[model samples]
Target: MSLQIYDTKIGKKIPFTPLRDNHVRIYACGITAYDFCHLGHARSALVFDMIVSYLRHSGYKVTFVRNFTDIDDKIINRAQKQNTTCAELSQRFIDEFYIDMKALKITPPDYEPRATEHIPEIIDIIEKLMTKGIAYQADGDVYFEVEKFPQYGSLSGRNLDDLKAGARISINKIKKNPMDFALWKASKPGEPKWDSPWGEGRPGWHIECSAMSRKYLGDSFDIHGGGEDLVFPHHENELAQSEGASGKPFANHWIHHAFVTIRDEKMSKSLHNFLTIREVLKRHQPEALRMMVFATHYRHPLDFSESGLRDAQTSVNRLYNCMAACAALTDGTESSKAVATRAEIDKLRSLPDRFQEAMDNDFNTAQGLGCLFDAVKSINRISQALPAPPAQADINLLRRGGADVTKLAQIMGLLSQEPQAYLAGYQEKHLTAVGMDKAELNKLLEERIAARQNKEWGRADEIRDLLLAKNIELKDSQDGTAWYVAGDRGQ
Candidate 1:
């Protein structure tokens, strides 16, 4: 199947061939940089990160740009509340955003333009709008004239008449029309200001993205993306400002990921239900959160819940266990003689193709993840059937299966850790979450081993019950005994 993208502009899935052959230029609207990133921000970042990964995996040379709005109303207000300069506050949060993105394993875009740094570019675009009669200056402020651009509402799928009907009467008397938005805001009491023709003022929110994206990705790029919440005024105004200024199409395709919600309500400060990325990271494995995000389709709402994260942890644990199992079977001490069938080898090798097929059809990561687990399930079943010290041919088959699953999983930034190391780290974290003393646990394990070795069955049973009561599950095998955190991790 040809790669397809669900373009929010045209409201349909289109066969996505780039504007230029063998190259894709993408620009995504980044955070405003006033606070720590939330789950919604993480989803947007990961969604585009997946897109970039898949495009490169498909042999497209990609140049991706994501811009930060460093000067906005929110930043000004937040700076005041924190008793700091807007630049200082924005920079601090941008640093925090990077830390969160790193923890989530998100790929950074090639160019990360800040609005304050691109003041000249912003002013140039605003001037272009003014020259084309698409913007007007009034009382030391500049506003985009929505009526000047006939295709104003096309990107957001809103007609002009309907928009005008639903539009509320703004209290601002300076704007020509109530629907018109600011291109440049006049300097406020203590907010950051820049010298522009409109007066000493900073660029407006929507204008910053248009200016920065053009500087990095040119007048027209292959793809533009953001959260769906940006579709209406933000992206719509950006579309109007860019196309109106340059008389060229701004971006060929537009993509928007849906929101992350809580109890069917969109995340907002008013509801107090949103979780920051670092906050969530403190309580759950970062990889587990990634799994949870990919479990749902990008355009579908993913409800935030503790149970959902626990389920994700279990799923991640299963995938890693599958890898660990393959490693053990493929250990070098196995029999060299070919004593097993090869029926499943070809099926195992076909996993990467299966995953790519899912990714090709509208970049369906949820479906792609399903393809990954399909291979894991087969490998697990085959491993269970094989004998101890399995034949070299069977071992070779397991190796191939493990290699195939790892190759595909990397595209989604999953299972990149060495199997044993990840499992061990998970155990350590689980140990900490349960408030179990590691040294004490080790002492108990040693004592239990001594009891088992001495055939003290009753004492061994008592120790086992004690550990199980604390949510530790024990398993006995030829290699000896091992334990796992059994129930709700509560982290």
Candidate 2:
């Protein structure tokens, strides 16, 4: 099926046709850099990341731009609270954002512009708006004239009257209309400021995205994405400012990921329920969090909970175990069984098409992941049916299956680790959680191996029971007995 994306402006899924053939230009509104990223930020980042990945995988030359709001009221306030300058505070959090995105395996955008760095572009847009009579200066402050733009609320579907009634307008009493938003804010004492036609001031929040996106992705781009919360005021204002200034559509497609919630409550710092990406990574494997995010449709709200994360961890464990089993069957030796398993391997080749079909439908990662799990199940079943030390043909089949699974998972930024390494790391994490010392566990394992070698079955059984009591179980393979946390053998 052809790619279809849900455009928030039109409120329906439409075919994704790029303005330029064979190329897709996308701009996603990035973080404010005032604090560490949270689950909500992860969802938006991963959603757009997956979208860009799929677009490129489908043979489109995608230039993705995501901007940082490094100079904002929040950053200023946070800087003061932390006893630092705005630039210093914003830089620290921007660094932290990169770390979080790296941990999540999110692909970096082609252009990551910072609002502070695009001051010239911002000033240029503001100047254009002033010349076009779409913006006016009020006591050194510049405000977008909402009434001047006939379609100001078309993207958000809110008329000017309704917006004026609902908007929390600035109490400065300088704007001509209640709904007029600031394009440039006159600098206050002790605040970061830049020289502009409207005097020394900084660009407003909405204006920053418009200026940065235009600078990198052009005045009109293919897709503009962010969280659903940005649909109004943020994105809506962006449309007015950009279109009002350039007299062209700001973006052809509008995509927004739903919020990440905790127990039905929005996860926010104000709510005291915000879980930073770093904290979540420390508690669970990063892949597990990625899995949890992809489990739900991108446009749907995701409920964050410890149980959900644990379930996702279990799912990732299963995939890795399947990979490990497939790896074990593919030792370099040749066997006759390879020919017999060829059909199963051939079946695995069709997975990419299935995965793509799910992703093409508005970047439905949940369905795409479903396809991945289905392949995992097929590989596991094939492994069980294959004989130990099977024909070279069977080994090839298992190898093919493993390679195909890894390739598909990599597109979603999962299964990047070696199967053995992932399994071992997961085992170690569980061991630590259960307070099992690795050194002590290793000593017991060695003693048990010696007992089994000497035919002291009772003593070996005793050691097994002792380890099991601590939630560690021993799996005996041809090489040796390996210990893992009990109840987590990827069963």
TM-score of each: 0.95, 0.93
Q: What is the TM-score of candidate 2?
A: 0.93
Tens digits of per-residue lDDT for model 1, 259-354: 899998998666788899998898888888889988888989989998999999899889999998877664534544543345566667778788
User: lDDT score of model 1?
Assistant: 0.87
**Cα lDDT, all candidates:** 0.87, 0.87
Off by over 4 Å in 1: 331-343, 489-491
Runs off by more than 4 Å, candidate 2? 167-172, 331-347, 388-394, 431-439, 450-458, 477-479, 488-491
